[model samples]
Target: MDLNVKITVLGAGAIGSLWAVALKQQQHDVQVWTRSSDSEYSVNYQDLNGNTHPLLFTANSVEHLSQSDLLLVTVKSFQVEVALAPIIKLIPNSCLIVIMHNGIGSHEAVKALFSNHCVFYATTSQAALKADAKLQHTGNGQTFIGSLFSANSSYNVLTEVFNQALSPCYWQDDIMEPLWKKLAINCAINPLTAIYQCTNGELANKNYQAQLIQVCNEVTLVMRAEGYRVKNDELYQQALTVINATADNYSSMNRDVFYQRPTEIDYITGYLIHRAKKFDIAVPVNTQLWQTIISMESSYHA
Candidate 1:
């Protein structure tokens, strides 16, 4: 595989747009395959240096997808199956598949669907948000990626490609640990932020401490039951670190609920609750948060 690979971003939201621009800047053949349009699209991006520019991308049609060397899926967790199902056959087996999203469990379906292909799961702390039609690059955090199906897959070429586009991207032998850890952080922050309708920093207040502790403890229990090495206090501390670091920001779930758009709750807390049931572990705190979010979504979606 070469460094300059033809890539198609499956979703053109903030993260997808960020990668599309980064890959294009690295001189990769990048196109965006979007649900809304088949025409050329442009992303209004604000780079880390406070530079604002328009990054244009061609529409990734079926023919373009067949020649694509990579398909980067950045849709919301619940949208993954639907978005990929329609184009699975169009994407060539030679194209690498990278699923990067907020929550987990969607990869299971993707693994089954693309069983023969090399599927990878990645977690990134790099933060980007859309504001008034422009994508803002906030945090330049490290990205960890690993193989989901092809354990013997060589990632040197892919790693280099990503590093050129975005520094500090590493390939991990076991991606699940980071995935679970990120899940713990999200479980502690996202839903609670939405439930309380507050910024991430507010969660650091003493009033929210008990809720945070219980959420982390529940998630830690499920994580341990699933055989991941984690501790309740560690998870809680990680969440607090993120909250304090991103004190002024509202979580993705908080924005989703505020805007009445679909959220990845089904994949975040919902996934945790499902696994807890499998292990017969009770996650009352998570269950409550999940139910509250579900109720809110239903009320608006109904």
Candidate 2:
């Protein structure tokens, strides 16, 4: 399709590095921006099958951002605003912006901040983690994208570029359903796994089955109140399916809490709790999990 554009990845973390390498392999002009003043120009990428390759990126310069046609943001949900505030003016107004992160809420903030640009939301199941200068592709999953603010933008170019770089990228007319579903899965599995220091599979055990169902029920109530047609049973079953699918791997929240790093519990469960309060809905279970994670985060330094 001869798709070539100047793409700038706003974060050099695991997810950011994964896509940076994938897009560069597709021959796009890819550069990365990191929080550190001293960062590498290349990333050591390890594919899903454990094949390691040295991938190079363009110079991380302010001028490159001005010429960027697309900005793919892969930062944590909480750091979205802080990371983009500095470089937001450097990027062209006409550039297509895609914020692909774990949880919700960041899309609204970005849409409001970048009012002139077409902001899109992407939810991906593809997992990766960073170790020093190396990025490991832990799992392969599809990507779903849809427009959050601008509905008239050209998605064909984005679909082709993303699909070729990372296969199975689907364009959805209503991306919120899939995004909420992903959040449902995260809400049900992530906190329990983190608290218990267990893998995803352990959530399927009898000991945790009731707790999992309660979490899903609370999330389903909030979802329906927020205008989504989600059922409690269906959400519970979906969580079970995910628990079986990624049985061995620990969730991102689990890893974050284990490493004493800040987790995105705020965006995942916190977003739901906020909506629940808006509708006068009771989400006690979700609230407890959110508070527990917040408590855990507080004890990170103690």
Q: How many residue pairs clash in all the candidates, one count each?
A: 0, 0
Candidates in order have lDDT scores of 0.88, 0.87
Predicted candidate 2 versus true structure: per-residue lDDT over 106-137, tens digit per residue: 87678778988878888988878788888898
| Runs off by more than 4 Å, candidate 1 | none
Q: What's model 2's lDDT at 210?
A: 85
lDDT of 1 by residue, 1-302 (tens): 78779999999888888888889999999999988765787878888899998877898577789899988999999999899998998988888899999988987789778976888888888888886568998778888889866574477788788888988998888888888889999999999999888999999999999999999999989999888878549999999999998888888999999999888998999999989999999999999999999999999957
- Residue 200 miss distance in model 1 (angstroms): 1.4
- Model 1 residue 3 distance off true place after TM-score fit, in angstroms: 0.7
What TM-score against the true fold does each predicted structure earn?
A: 0.96, 0.95
RMSD of candidate 1 to the truth, in angstroms, is 1.4
